[model samples]
Target: MTAPSSPDTQAENAEVIARQRVMRVLAQAPDQQLEELYEKFADKPDWTFARKPETGLVMTRGRIGGGGAPFNLGEMTVTRAAIQLKSGEVGHAYCQGRNQRKAAIAAFFDAAWLSEAHKQSVEANIIAPLEQEQLTAKKDKLKKAAATKVDFFTMVRGDG
Candidate 1:
C-alpha cells in the first residue's frame, strides 16, 4: 500500500492542472485576442523566457472509432515556450503550429495569470471569455456532428 498524498502535493497538482487548462485555452485563441486581453492588466509585469519559443514536430495518435487499436495519425508542428516572471513564478505553454510569438505570449500570460497582482484581471477578461468561446465552439461542433450521426436500434415485437 502507498501513503496518501500530502495536502501540499494535492494543491500543487491542482495548480499544475489549472495552468495546463489555461495554456490550452490560450493556445487556441487568436494572438490578437490574447494581446488585447493582456492590455487589461493594470501594470505589465516583466517576464523573461526560461526557454525561448521553438517549433518541433510531435506524433499524433488516433484510436479507431474512438476505441479499439490506436494508430499513429501523423506528425504535427507544435511550438513551446517557458517564461519566468520577475517574482519567480514560472509558466510554460505548448501550442499547435508554428507561432513562436503566440507561444511566448501564452507563456507570459500563464505566468502573469498566476501572479496575485494579475489573477483577478486575467480570470475576468482573459480566461473567462476564452473558456466561454471554446465552450460555444465545442457545442456548435458537437451539434453539427450529432446531426449526421446515425443511430440504429432493433425493436422486438411481441407477436414475433
Candidate 2:
C-alpha cells in the first residue's frame, strides 16, 4: 500500500526546494551571485540570480598600538551566486573579488539539473574551465616566484 504524505514530509520537500534556489545564485561568479531571482525552469535547472555593482570594503578601524583613529584599508567588488540542480538541489556562494569557485559550484548544480547523458558534457565545459584556470594560475605564480630568486653575497674586511 502507498503511504500518505504527512506534514513532516511536506516540510521536508519545501526545504529541499529552497536549497535548489540557493545553488543557482552561487553558481555565477561572486559578483553575479547577487542577482535578483527571476525565471524558473522545469525541465532544465530552475532558479535565477542577478548582479548589482556593489563595493565590498575591508577596513581596519584601529589597533591598540595605533588606535588614534579608524580608516578604510581596502575595498573589493563582491558578487553573490546561486543555482538549482536538476534533482532540486540548490546551492549558494558569496565571495569577495571575482571568483571561479562561485561559478563552478553553480554550474555543477546546473549540470545536476540535466539528464545523466548531459552531465559529462556540462562538467567538461563548465566545471573544467575553473579547475584549469586555477591550475594554470598556480603554475604561473610558482614560475614567476622561481624566476625572482636572489643570492646574497658577503664580504670580509682584511686586517693590515
Candidate 3:
C-alpha cells in the first residue's frame, strides 16, 4: 500500500497532463497551420531560447501486432526547442520533422501556457482550435476508410 497523494500533488499532476495534451496537439499540427494560428497572438511576449530549435534523429520502437515483443522500428527526424519567458516560465517542445520554426513556436506556446495570465487565452485560441482540427481530420479519415471496408458472409445450403 502507498500513501494517497495530497491536493497539491493532484493539482500538479493535472497540470502536467494538460501540458502533455497541448504538446500532442502542437506536434500533430501542420507547420503552416501552426504558424497561422500562432500569428493570431498579437502581443507576443519576449522570450529567450534556453535551447534553440534543433533537428535530430530519434530511434522509434514498435510492438509486434500492437501487443507482442517490442522491436526497434527505425529512426525518425525530430525537432525540439526550449524557451524561457521573461516572466520566468520555461517551456519545451518536441515535434516530429525538421521544422525549426514550428518547434520554436510550440515551445513559446508551452511557456506561455505556464503563465496564469495566458493559460486561458492559450487554451481557448490555440489548443482548442488545433484539437478540433485534428479531431475533424481523424474523423474524415476514418469515414473514408470505413467506406472502403468489405463485409462478407458465408451461405449455407441445405443437404439431406
RMSD to the true structure for each prediction, in A, is 3.4, 12.0, 2.7
Ranking by TM-score: 3, 1, 2
lDDT of 1 by residue, 1-160 (tens): 1357698888888887887788889999987777777666567788899999999999999999999799999999999999999998887889898989888888888888888988787777788889999999999999999999989776878864
**What C-alpha root-mean-square deviation, in Å, does candidate 2 show against the real structure?**
12.0
- Model 2, 1-160: lDDT tens digits are 1367689888877766654443433343233332211112123444444332233544434544576556665565554455555455544454455654445445444545344654555445434554455568779999999999988665665751
lDDT of each: 0.86, 0.48, 0.92
* Residue 16 in model 3: lDDT: 81
Counted clashes in each candidate structure:
0, 26, 0
Q: Which model is ahead, 2 or 3, in terms of TM-score?
A: 3
Candidate achieving the largest TM-score: 3
Model 3, residue 104: displacement in angstroms? 0.3
Return the TM-score for each candidate structure.
Answer: 0.79, 0.41, 0.89
Comparing 1 with 2 on lDDT, the higher-scoring candidate is 1
Cα error of candidate 1 at position 155, Å = 10
Report the C-alpha lDDT of model 3 over 37-132, residue by residue, as the tens digit: 788896788899999999999999999999999999999999999999999998899999999999999999999988887888888999998999
Clashing pairs in 3: none
